[model samples]
Target: MDTRYITSAAKPEQLPDFDLPELAFIGRSNTGKSSLLNALLGRRSLARHGRTPGQTQMINFFSVNDKVVLADLPGYGYNVARRDVAKHWQPMVDTYVRRPNITAFLCLHDCRRNFQELDERLMFMLGRQLPIILVLTKTDKATRNEIRKQKEKLKKRMDELGIDYQVIIETSATKNQGIAELKALVLDPHLQVEDENS
Candidate 1:
């Protein structure tokens, strides 16, 4: 069966004790993070719809197979109108990434725009320990050449940082592009070694 919804955690303390591995999805608000999560699970709308510039309030959870958990973190880059919201979310995201149970992080970015400095900072901060999969989402909205250009820019930045992520994927939930590869990457740990080895 395809992965289905199990439950959500509004707070880190409420998260259950699970020896199984955990993965997280994080990005700026409206970066299509929730859409990608639903796409990864092969469901239309499993993860809730977030605000245009959302508040960082919860660490939502889903059952990815029976062996692992998927944590949907509050989107980090909400606007200034929600300064307090960002304050609340920044700590939760920092803690979740540092948590012992987290296996990896799927850091989603919008393909149509230049990535922000904060994105780079977050990657720099988190890359120290957990593996991060840099996913360029909404590729369908951009031209092929544009996609290529953006990919190269991201690669250069990552290489310069010397923070090797397990892998980088480009996806468009609308076109069903790169969804299966992402799901497999998230579901199977073996791919990470081979991906890094190659």
Candidate 2:
């Protein structure tokens, strides 16, 4: 019923060896990924809170009830002067995205800014492979009217992309809204296995 932070690892090989489903969280820098994680778990300081925009350079793994795994992926966005450190991210992140255990990816985009060129490019590279659920972050900063308008815009984009089983969810980690529905859609059934034990 509740999700919690398990661990943070730098390398993919260090990820815990378990067949449990993995719900990965990904987004652009300053898109409220860390805050959303804490909000989803109903805790304030569960995931490392960082002030720097592009702070999550390494991949973080969080376990949920021993049956599911929540992976906190590094945020993708331009960080002036620190570009070299993130050189290895896109490729490595792509691999993990394509991995079989990746039940679903929460591809967050700042609602204030429409999805960017980089986001579009990554979506193309993914090539209809992994199931992705787009999360519109930072709703608390916008007016209700503005949020609805953005949702319509993003919906049109998804339709144009022909992405199947994809969904767009609006959330404000600060407001604690849309957290439950997002979890239900991605984490619950996406990774659910037909019980072999059954």
Candidate 3:
């Protein structure tokens, strides 16, 4: 699939006009959000990766196959100082989430750590509108048993909260695991139909 960088918006009003279906990826800082985006698009550095956490401070958009738009939202829950920055960006995320064109959310979580409070809050906020595909990132860094446990734990939490989710996928950008499934989930019309029906 062909993909190109679009524009970065600090606020919702600054976002470029686009009518195509949009899917957004969001997670905590250093949670492999950029890496997963690069993997999905089959590009090495399409979404720039930074050494510092909370480096992505704006809402970034990328056009894929001229059919769908992929949004790389700023990561949340970094540190006290960065948390303040995240507070400023939260409203922008809220506005974008409410946009009519956004079809779904690819919510990434680090498989190595237990789900944090920020992840729960984010899920609560986004789950109300769009169908979310919970992605467990950096799965290669964890053992199979650990991955399975984390998935079950997260699924239970999501179930308890009554969050709307399509699936929980384990991914390792380095290993190229779950990249195809993630792409299918994002681009497959049949999956969207099934999600809407569900």
Q: List residue ranges in candidate 3 displaced over 4 A.
A: 189-198
Alpha-carbon RMSD of each model: 2.6, 5.6, 3.1
lDDT of 3: 0.81
Assess the local accuracy of residue 122 in candidate 2 as a C-alpha lDDT between 0 and 100. Answer: 66
lDDT of 3 by residue, 1-198 (tens): 888998899976897878888888998888989989999998899898867888767888988888888999888777426666767687787788888788888899898787777788788878888658888899889898887777777778888888888777778999999887878866763364332211
Expressed as tens digits, the lDDT of each residue in 37-99 for candidate 2 is: 888866788777667777667778876767788888887775524767566675557567767
Top model number, lDDT = 3
Point out the worst 10-residue segment of candidate 3 by lDDT. Answer: 189-198
- What's the TM-score of each model vs. the native? 0.89, 0.85, 0.91
Ranking by lDDT: 3, 1, 2
TM-score: model 1 vs. ground truth: 0.89
Candidate 2: count of backbone clashes, pairs at least 3 residues apart or interchain: 1
Query: Highest TM-score among the candidates is held by which one?
Result: 3
Of 1 and 2, the candidate ahead on lDDT is: 1
Candidate 2 residues lying further than 4 Å off, grouped into runs, are: 191-198
